[model samples]
Target chain A: MLPNLVVAQAHDSVMWDYTRKMFLGDALYQFDDRIRVSLPEFAEDSMQVPVSVDASAIDESIVKMITWADYNPIQHIFTYHPEPGMLPQVSITFKVQQSTPVRAAVLTESGQWLVGSGYVSAAGGGCTLPSESRMNDDWQSSLGQIRAGRFSSTDQPGADRYKFRIMHPMDSGLVANIPSFYLEQVELRSANGDLQVRLELSPAVSENPSISFDLLSSDQNYQLWVRDNDGNEFQRAL
Target chain B: MAMNSNEHFEGVAMVFKHLRYALMGLVFCGSWVQANPLDYALTPKEIAPNTWVVTGLTEDFTTQNGGNIVNTAFIVTQEGVLVLDTGPSKRYGEALRQVISEVTEQPIARVYNSHHHPDHFLGNQAFADVDIYALATTIDLIKSRGEAYTENMYRMVGDWMRGTDVLLPNQIQTSGQEIIGGHSLRFMAFSGHSGAQADLVILDETTGVLFAFDLVFYDRALTTPDTPGLMQWLEDIEALSLLDFKTLVPGHGEVTSSTKPLEQMREYLKWLDQVLTDSAAQGLVATEVMRVGIPERFSSVALAAQELQRTVSHLYPNYEDAFFAESF
Candidate 1:
């Protein structure tokens, strides 16, 4: 166990320990540099902070990927299972309750969990506050509206980026009398209707949740399907 | 029983003696403390013939300062006093009125809010009777985010924000020239700092004094949570510099006669834009971009590092989006 490397790179917190146990279930894990977790140092707008996980550098085939914020009221962010066509890369926006370590854990085919972590400093008040959607009178009309597109990656020729945003409140249920209403499941499919990646989202995701994924470029268009906890389903073609 | 009664009387006498001392202390030090704690100590400085600016501390909001980190000015003319930008809170606004009263006998005829930021207009409660004027977009922004900003202020500065409520500007200020109290004022609307059609810059053609609110931070680091874009801000700065003004009053820093403020704004804004764009192109993470070293030139500017970190958090994601993928 590279203790120095772990101490230098990973700023361990008590919440991270608890989150690790709850998510990984005492599995064998290592703080791996190959799996990179990136987030802003300060959450300027705590309700929506852009973060990403890139485990594409790891040579091993990833079996499962999970991400969580250490100090959020709801620690879980998302869990992703990438099929053959998708890369082990995911970008998302989430709410940060406070300054805490955000981690992305990727389980490989070798049965070892590789964790990447980053810290975000915030003024907090992200979870407890009511969302803008709650105040808008016509929020229902805009709810679950999906806007998505597939663009060719400028840097990488053979890769295409799938980006989508779904109108949602993503309420964490921490505010008074506001129940948890958020996107629960997201599916990305190739042109042939083959499952490329499936994402399980939580209330920890930001309002108007936006996500991105990079995959091998193909001739046909892609499709996105999302469902919220309230059973509202939205579909978009890119 | 006789001895116990005598001892009780002696104890009562001692208590009275201590109470007398406490009363004396309260008469002297307690009055000063009570009167001084909430007082803004606003002193109007005459920057021009009839233009007085009540400058605030160039610092972040604190319980000690009570969110007095903005400059509010007033121009006394033949007709009356035309106020530009109220202070942070009701207490500050009342104090400002008191300061204005001390300088001249003119009543506050009108009020102009430069933008919808809490510091610029939360004190509208003090001038609630006056016909407060602001841009239409600014009025809309205040209507939407003013309550949240008020709540945030109460959390930041505590009791200083007492009785501070959002008061919408009753009149709309458009892009044109207007003569108020013998002062020929030119109102130009700029969308770079806050949002599109929010920031209103005024030029006093009479005194050649330009009130460049929030658009020019002078020696302070600018806040950009609501800024439309850096390029737009740079364009606004260029447009403001072209105005024929002898004295420049920035929204945050000290009043200046030189063009140093405009130069500094251009330099800082271009550096910020360049740093963000290059860092995004290089795929630097937000944390790494925030940690990038500040230029030596900006060392004298207050809150440069802190505001840079905040700017990165607010704007870097957009820059990253330009380089990476697109989100609708």
Candidate 2:
């Protein structure tokens, strides 16, 4: 039984090796469990599923994090760079094609790769479906607009919850003739110019990406800076 | 996934059937014990000689109330009855049917859905046998988004949505007049409150009663999650106010004989649009706009603060884009 268990472990490593080769190329790293991925057990709407990744347990050693859906046709989702004074946590909404395993691989300054995974069961065709914003004629006129606000948490004192949304089509390349145009990075900063949270996004993120997170500070002043892949930058103070 | 009928013996089938019946009995008993009568009981008030309306609570959807927060009306004529809008759930529809029966023995000939809002059309499941009519856009949106809305209602109001299913309106309505039940009912489709679907306004030529669903919210604050433009909504109100009507039944508020509701709606929407536009012109983000002080006049409006906060999120982006374009 002990030998069989060892063989099974080897098989699992072999599968991870193939996946890593497909995504990360020839990068060498170690798997750590400090990173965590959270998603709904069953996706109520395949077009918009809430997803969050928390690497707070890893402290300040993390430099970048990459996430993907293992079964999606376009497996690459996004890559994040946590700046100084930023928490290693992110929340974003996404669109999944079907029931698939979602993985978040975090890379630390020490060259360690911590992987966390979650399964989201979807009915199907979130990618193939036409954009919901297509119904509106002036969707392009409102692109890159951001709405940001913070509310004090009633359940947890001293925790201010920040919620914001950016108006973007987030068109997936899979859609016919709708080139991949999405917000690539977002940075939330305090009044003192300290980075609070940073997010890297992709086309998989739903149109008008809405996100919420908790800030441990009581300061009411903050600013949001966002830049899409097309080099359109927007910044606003809250 | 095909079932193998020959694999299971007669003995397994007998035991399983008995077990299933026992489970079903327990389920029925549990639901009966938990059911509350007040949650489903909605009384209809007669605003006109033959028109009756069931005004829903002004509060938001909750697990206890089960999202019974919209107005549903019916008109009885010489031939049969015509329902304006269905309530929020299957149970509400059934209760409404009982109330209609109590009022008159006339059969429900046709049902008209005001828009694609789940609160307006989910009750179509109860009157599936009748011809449910709506605008073409409303029908299309309901067909695509009905299931998601039903799922959301279940999550919101819990068991109040039990046995509730998505029912699409089968008939399409255009901007015209129809003589139904010996009354000249004029129907108009206009866009405002809901961006995806147009609102339905029906006017009975006999009583001059206008069924303005979601187009005019009297005392309560209007929902803007699907509102494409406040300007468009204001224009729609202007158009509606011009019509000659004796009584107006809004989608969510109380019925009124005067044009006070239309005036109040126009005032609120105009003020809201001004606030958002000015805030955007100053380059204030959504959070800053949400913090702006509400005018003294709007302070009395129900959910004014809450709806303003939501409206900023929905419309500030377009305002900001307009501001940006102007600056350049």
Candidate 3:
């Protein structure tokens, strides 16, 4: 680690925050530094904050990665971890509610932790979905197509990529409380019982679930299944 | 005065007809005042002394299942006007031109495409009279991707762009600098979305308005995964903020004097980069990352949910695999 990286733990402003110093064993979050990466001097009022972290310093394998703000109602953005022989670098795109400090912490191998913090500003709550309507939107993958039946893969690579547009309203549930609820899970598998991947999701994902991954040339048929936090399940295949 | 009952009846009939005409006129005026959403011009606001950006009904490309036609732009210059990007149809491009003519009649000296996407380049036929410009990479994509896209457009607006020669850029942008209309402009190559994309930064040798193109999506969705480098795209946006321009014209949205969106784009990139990196350690599959969305800090951007999902899908697959192969 460079000793010269200055820490701004003492300063504070309404539009930005570059006052926090990163300590050893703390979560390393992006755009939280005094001189943030790819930002407008870390001071200008802005919306989305691009964040990244490097966790190679730890000895144990990382099991999960999560991010949250001290003030946000939704504390977990995404949980990702390498299966094995995988490197650890967690990056995400996020918004700043206002001139607020942001944090990123890694759940390390030794059951220990590290986190980094920075600041950004928000003009208004995002204009996409209203905080109240956030609940009513469908954000979980619709296994509706899976039930329609399975089909064979096309011969060409780009020409015949089987496409699945999952429906979910990933309401992070942090916006003003709405009358609706959130989606929970999505699953995909091969029709021949060869291909499958299970995903346990949260509101941290986007609304109207959209999930796509490649099926190797050999995989003949495929299936997709979904479930909400309420244990509801949906399945589709191609 | 009518001397007979028949004459009186005819006079009344004439009065009724006149009143009906008056009522119809009033209704017409009221309806005209309520203009259709499509009726509004893609108003080209003069952002700089010689530059302008047109903001219209910015539709999400994916949401339309890829049917949005126009949200265009222009780069005005005293020497001549260089239209940056064109809309979907000739009519859309011409509508853009009609609004453009409201300012100067300088020949549309050159049309420089920032990338190869159809929304930004399909209306090439409308500007057929001028030399078109694009990156060498963009030219290659248009040849391959554009051919397929054009065939698709043939089904949609073929009659409008019939016999229109789809010309490649006679001039390819190679460096960060170019001289246009006697003023210097910077063309930076950013390839996170397309294989070879260009973001044209127009700075006034006098005024500092920048036609940022798609590099900055203020108040709109960030980006869709047309390619594999969301992180690099974020880097490009951050790099733009270091520049001196005070005003910016995004590819699909309104012109803004604020530098805040650039910063916002940066933060969003940083967040995505970190999330992907963290996932890499666990060997998370690309689909797994898709289930996990972006943070609340980004929850507010207009199309954040859809874009966040797409960005994750494109970047994480390569990212997770890369880390497994080399360890990020």
Candidate 4:
């Protein structure tokens, strides 16, 4: 049996169990500590809550990683597939409606799931109201704009941090008159045209999606490509 | 007892009518107290010659306090009363104005917003007719982020934030010495508090009082959501301590005559920086970092644990990025 790093309470959360059954469909899973989910204890702004999920500690070979919020109106946050030989770690921002448990489920190559959990308390109302970008008359003009950069860590000589932000309102369609609009696909590729990772984002993401990834240092430049649900494509080189 | 039917019916009807009236009176008095707790209960204490400060409670925002957690003051000058900052909501601003009037007959001549934080400037709606002044960058920040802050305030404080709207300052204030009436004032701008380009700090050379806005929090823990960096904030505190002022009015907490507030701020900032750095070096996650023990010296500081948690949330990632990325 796998080490029971996380208590049964995490798996026993009524909402989490329901969500797991509904989404994972009785897949073999266990609450494991190797998968770590980090979030604020109290979300200062319900609109933008930072979340980091790292599955690099797991000794098993990973297949894919999926994350969700148990209480979010749109529970699915993202599903990330790290390309072969890439580390399974990502940081992103999302909207939370209220206090909820956020879980990151990592699927290992052995056909088992390892889950990490964290709880965040919020002041509520993250998805009900329309985003600021939706209200701007000129929001369309700046749509699909991308600001991205990669920083080399001075302490970790062989590590690089990639941070990027895309200008698109990830409207959850919960608000009246605003349809569900969000980045549906994101791809990171090396200069030599090698795929690094691919991410599927849900409307649970905050407006103007910003994401960060930690990877090994490389001399080659990288390009990020994003596609929204509306079929609009945004690309930038970092 | 002979013809009791009609008389008995009339008496019962009269009793019911009187009961209804009494219930209505009780409701009127109850709601008069409940719905009207918007009163800020502002009392201006004269700190210096013609200078008065209206201090707020050193607590977090709540419906009960109505977001009255900032210090706003006014200088009754020879020309007119120069207001420092408007309080949190329009009601608080109106209360501040009324308190100012009670102290001196001088009309509000000029108004200055210390920064773009909602608590410091949301009250701008009350002083709509006055020419409010702030740094050009501050005005821009208010325009960009003020609405979101207003929304968050409404969520945090509920009904207390009603009628509060974002009102942009009309005039631009720069760093310089200006003589208003008989008081010579020096306006300085710093960016350690709010990540916005600047935070306004004012010094009354004539009165020897420094209005060190959000740059200095005395007994209360300083907020760090929009701060550029803790080291930068420490530099600002160091510079502020060098200012020649007899009376120091921090953005929060009580007014002081000694340099204890500055000393406390400096020591607290240094300690916070050390904690973040050490936690990062230890490869601790945000949750672990937040749970780290705070020093006993900070026991007297209000909301230290809460603010430390918030700071860890806001800044720990940068520290973690500096550490190892073991991909085992």
Candidate 5:
């Protein structure tokens, strides 16, 4: 659970003050020693926790993958899946309320859940995104990042490459947001709403969200439907 | 509509004038540019034989007309590189590898994020394979406030934004000197400005180059959003004046071998900071401040009240209510 280096605990030591006594081999479940649970230590409370998951020597016949973390309040920090094409690496940035025991609940591909625990030193502060850096007042009214690029390559066998970018403030609604909060639901689709793809997001997603992923096979047109959190729908076709 | 038209008229003239000056600066740079600190292959510049600096270059910040603007910097050494800052994107880190390959092929052992901002450090994933470096407090701030800032930026500008999730540094150190790869560098953290966030100094004894990230904004318009404004930066500029350096590579604008550009940035900061200070005293608030605008002379440089008003708003938020009331 803890990293290797330990530090002197003082009120002023926000940066360096902790260590990890336990580590695992390749598998996330098996600790080097036969310890029941692994605990994480802290040198700094503000930075995101650097996590390492090892699940090597498991007969793997029992379980494939597992998740780890200190469960301060919210039990579920993250979930990971290890399969043929998947490398079981689970890393996420989360907030800690206080010095608490972090835990990881792993659900194997075989449907078994294994739990591990860790300790993280927490910092005190209302770590909110500064107001000055907040979004523009009319941020929701317009899509600021409407972008598209065309690249022609004769090298590829039988494929044309095109990418589209949409300007969206996917406000996670986490901050003590300024009022009149209007949420316009958004989706990706073809010219018709039939080929729609709905994305799941939380307040953790940043304000302006830029997703650069490629779509295949169609040379015609693609559309994006942004239903304002307020329900007003807008559409852009590329 | 008429007023906007009038502003456009004024803005057009300002744009023309700035274009003229920018052209002049480019020509002057072309003519007097004796020290070609870059080899066209190295992504970061090397002050000494092996030492290098991070240049945060992104695909963004281009002129509507045509020109490229680099984002941050890093200075490297042999055992590990003393990065001035992380680059703007993951690709920037990839680009950095190209630069390192041009030189001695020594691995970038360590990175120092000049400030907590992401453009300077968003390329962290690229350096994830190695040990990165930065100020202890900065690491904390970055860990806490950095991602939120990034999320919001993605919200505002979208994915075209350079680096994402480039937060996190491997090690932390206080101000002073460290010996790495045979080069000695003094990491001076000048205070009283930028809320202890941006005041950074990278002095390479080998090449006599001072790599100051946001402590200097190269040839671009000066940024004064947080604690340290013109006054603190002015003092910093003055202090830097005493240092002997043959060249200076900044966070935003151009590369310099002289103090002249730094002086210009100082003047710009002073001018805007003073104007905003006086204007705030006079009860001018947000939009009005943006509306009334900057001086005619400086309307061109980098920013005017046009940009500064938004900046001052962030640095000083209480001024907004009155800003809305004034409504230009």
Candidate 6:
């Protein structure tokens, strides 16, 4: 699993020092080779950049996983607690304000931080831009629409890729009158009712959240369940 | 122990050989080619009498070629010329203006933006003095999302967008026929392709030329980043086929007179819709759906494989969501 990691970040040494101290809170962190961060080298759309964190090698011993952007004004992106029977791997789409270090810190059952980091260069202003859906009058009626699909991985053999998006305002509370509202939790499950992955999100993600990840299986049947902070639950099967 | 003189020379020769091979690899791979300002050398071919179009290359946006992948046209009448949708950047627009000047001495009087897509309207800055027209919804969308599109284009094409800026069209194009330069032009606004009240198809009554801007793609695969659905786009094509036009200028690809391009577009879109909807109903995830084989009928369409992948990424999730709701 470590050999498949793509190390495109040029400032790995410097980013590790700053992000480790900022996120780990002086706790001892081992640069776990099994942890991998996958993101595009250059963000095509700063508003909706896709990122995935794969820690399947150490899934059983993981407790909590925290992901953040070191250069964002709202640095804390999300934190996930992989439920029992769930894989430690998860994918999410979020906003990035420029070229910044994105770090994922995995806390193990033994209380050690396993750190993985990558860099994504953005065109800036994803965090502050107003939602494009706001321009339409029927935005409210269209909220909570969910879409999901899957494809076989071309690069990673035996692994299938999955992508889904939910229509929501994902308001960051920075804009006047629009309070903080976003999907709080998402869970993916197999046809046999086994948890595959879990995600925790915040307002830092772009509107109409698009999430994508790879499952190391050829199985086609799966279900995606999501809930917002407002108690709006949505589910889709594919 | 220090190396002998002969041994040192041998080690240096090996290092030089490795360096030479590395340099050769870079050249052979052509991975070092950076973004450069493209000389479009735009030439307008008259598809109809007094109406000319500058065809753009049917290719994806790349740093090496910039994002000049759009069709722009102009109609010269007794009055000044009326320009159609502009190209991708300010430079492209400036070059287009030069080409138009060489064709006729008439000043460009009015500019019509087919939709709010950056490739259709980002060149508005070059026609600042002229009255640019677009749908009201398009004007609003550009005001809201123009900056984000501009930033994304800059990252995709790099320095080619150096002088480009987001310039919104001021005039509103109501749904009706209007006389411009003694030629009766009919305009209909629809929303299917770009989803945000986009796709404006213009028809010239005198010359029987239809400027179906992003609404039609000759041989190129359609873009779906903002598409509402395949059904709506099919309806749009049906409406376009009803028009009495001898020549058709699509948003991308070469100009043509036959209805074969429209037929191809309809067949491809129908197939895509069926494949995605059926896959979702069968409870297949995006990965599995993407692996579904492309029919040989669409094998000849440019970027069919790649565009199919993108379409799955964009639309399959919605189908899955609908399927889930129905099951529940």
DockQ of each: 0.14, 0.09, 0.02, 0.10, 0.01, 0.09
Pick out the ten consecutive residues of candidate 1 chain B with the lowest summed lDDT.
B319-328
Q: What is the lDDT of residue B224 in candidate 2?
A: 88
Given candidate 5, what's the lDDT at residue B326? Answer: 19
Mind giving the per-residue lDDT tens digits that candidate 6 earns over A9-37?
42454455565576687886666657777
Q: Cα lDDT of all candidates, in order? A: 0.87, 0.78, 0.54, 0.85, 0.49, 0.79
TM-scores, each model vs. reference: 0.73, 0.60, 0.49, 0.69, 0.47, 0.68
Per-residue lDDT over A1-238 for candidate 3, one digit per residue giving the tens place of the 0 to 100 score: 4233323432333212322221223334433232221211231112233444445555666665444443333434444443443345444344344445555455556664445455444432431344322344332323222212111223323222333334444445455654234455544555566434443544544444333333334435555566766566555444
Every candidate's CA RMSD: 7.1, 10.6, 20.7, 8.3, 28.3, 8.4
Preferred candidate (lDDT higher): 2 or 6: 6
Q: Given candidate 6, what's the lDDT at residue B283? A: 52
Query: Which is the leading candidate under lDDT?
Result: 1
- The segments of candidate 6 whose C-alpha lies over 4 angstroms from its true place after superposition are A1-14, A20-84, A87-91, A99-124, A129-238, B1-39, B61-66, B128-131, B143-171, B176-184, B195-197, B275-317, B326-328
Q: In terms of TM-score, which candidate is stronger, 2 or 6?
A: 6
* Weakest ten-residue segment in model 6 chain B by summed lDDT: B31-40
The list of candidate 4 runs beyond 4 A from truth reads A1-20, A24-38, A45-67, A78-99, A103-118, A123-238, B1-36, B321-328
Give candidate 2's fnat, 2 decimals: 0.00
Q: Candidate 5: which stretches are off by over 4 Å?
A: A1-238, B1-80, B156-163, B296-300, B303-306, B316-328
Q: What are the per-residue Cα lDDT tens digits for candidate 4 across B1-328? A: 5658999899999999999999999999999989776678898998989999999999999988999999999999989999999988888888888888898888889999999998999888878888999999999999999998899889888887778899999999999999999999999999899875588999999999999989999999999988999999999999998899999999999999999999999999999899998866644445556767879998879988889888876786666556533211
Candidate 2 lDDT tens digits, A88-204:
666667889978777788888787776776677776677777678865757788887776655565545666656667778888878787778778888878888888667777788
Sort every candidate by TM-score, greatest first: 1, 4, 6, 2, 3, 5
Better structure of 1 and 2 per TM-score: 1
User: Among these predicted structures, which one has the highest TM-score?
Assistant: 1
Ten-residue region with minimum lDDT total, candidate 4 chain A: A1-10
Q: Which wins on DockQ, candidate 5 or candidate 6?
A: 6
